[model samples]
Target: MRELITKYKPVIKFIVLFLGAYLLLSVAYGGYLKVSSHYGYTPDFITDLVANQSSWLINAAGYKAQVIPHDAKPQMKLIVDGNYLANIIEGCNAMSIIVLFIAFVIAFAQKLKKTVLFILGGSLLIYIVNIVRIAILAIALYKYPEHQSILHSVVFPGIIYGMVFLLWMLWIKMIKKSAT
Candidate 1:
């Protein structure tokens, strides 16, 4: 057992660091949400952006869309043509991307000089993709309200995860090239 552990020490360290960082980020994010809710400091930027985009989506679909705040929670509920379609909660959609990035950073800790830029760029891309995802989801809900469940639960998650996978692949390619 000791011999085996010594042989794969690097791999074990990578896994431990990745898991620790990911867990810490998740906990911090959850705490942020809780405190933000309690103090009513949730950023107005997303809410306003969604509201404006909802109007456009509603007009395009010829259906009335309403985005209203939940009374008991710090979340936005999207109502489409008088029916509840989806709820936009803080840290709900981008949790995977955030966690995955933290994991990736930890996994690349030794190569920080080469990887930090990649990490930052990837994070920015993820953020932009998230906004696009939300917008596309809004449009999707407007176009095919009946398919909201699949789109919201499955398709969107796949998109974000797919993007994260692509980012990781890109990182690997870059690291390989650097080694060569």
Candidate 2:
């Protein structure tokens, strides 16, 4: 048992770090949600920010885009060109994705300064990409309502997750190069 543990120490360490970070961040987020709801921030600040940015981008693309609070839920209703397109929910905010990204990056962390910088930069990149993704998705939905299922379920998810995967790979390569 000791030999096996010694042999796989790095793997074990990675797993523990990843799970610990993920759980801690997720709990913090849940607390934020609870507090926001308690204080009357219906959609929460991050989700609202994402919705507003997405709407701004869609408007910049020549569409009359706007976001309004949902009447029955904690979400924003995205309207483009007077068409009811999609709902911007808390999940759409991408904080969860950022949390996942941060967890993975921390698992493979190199140095304190580099790790913190990467987390900050990577989180910002993910947030911006999510806003753009939401904008493009809204525009695509407005243009091709028929393909809504595929666009929402598969394609857009692939884009964001794919971007995170690429970032992870880049981080690994960067650390390896620095170590050498």
Candidate 3:
């Protein structure tokens, strides 16, 4: 038993630490969801604000817009009309933190500096990408509603996973550079 324990100590330590962190984060997120749901506050807030301030976003993009709630859906819905196109936008507007968390964990595992600046920069980029993704998805839904399921289930996940892969690749490159 002692020999077996010694042989797997490092692996056991890694698993314990990873599981501990994962559990902590999961609990924290669950609390956040509970509070948000209880207060009726969520990404829906962003959708509401966007719908209410439709002109700012649309006019800035040089598009005429009209946003109205769709009775059938439990989310914010919008209709935008531009110079030559029209679109329907519906869904939550909050960035998915799961992807960001995964990225952070990957970086941490690679021993990247946990400096505030580094975290902030990475978080900002992730948030920006999420916004772009939501907007693009809205446009895609409007233009090709028939393919919504494929885009949502496959393409969107692929994009986020691709970002994760790129981040991992960057970590590998950094590791190689440091070793020299």
RMSD of each: 3.5, 0.6, 5.0
State the displacement of the C-alpha of residue 9, model 1, in Å, after optimal TM-score superposition. Answer: 1.6
Query: Clashes in each model (backbone N, CA, C under 3 Å)?
Result: 0, 0, 0
- Candidate number achieving the greatest TM-score relative to the actual structure: 2
Question: What shift in Å separates residue 124 of candidate 2 from its native position after superposition?
Answer: 0.3
Candidate 1 segments whose C-alpha is farther than 4 A from its true place: 42-66, 79-84
What pairs collide in candidate 3?
A: none
Candidate 2 residue pairs in backbone clash: none
Query: Model 3: per-residue lDDT, tens digit, 15-120?
Result: 7765676667667755755565566543345455545454345445554455555565434445555322222332333234543455345434544463344445
TM-score of each prediction: 0.78, 0.99, 0.64
Which is better, 2 or 3, measured by lDDT?
Answer: 2
The candidate, 1 or 3, that scores higher on TM-score is 1
What does candidate 2 score on TM? 0.99
lDDT of the candidates, in the order given: 0.71, 0.96, 0.54
Give a tens-digit lDDT track for model 1, residues 95-120: 55766885776686647666667767
Clash tally for model 3: 0
- Compared with the true structure, what per-residue lDDT tens digits does model 2 show for residues 22-138? 999999999999999887766998899899999999999999999999998999999999999999999999999999999999999988999999999999999999999999999
lDDT of 2: 0.96
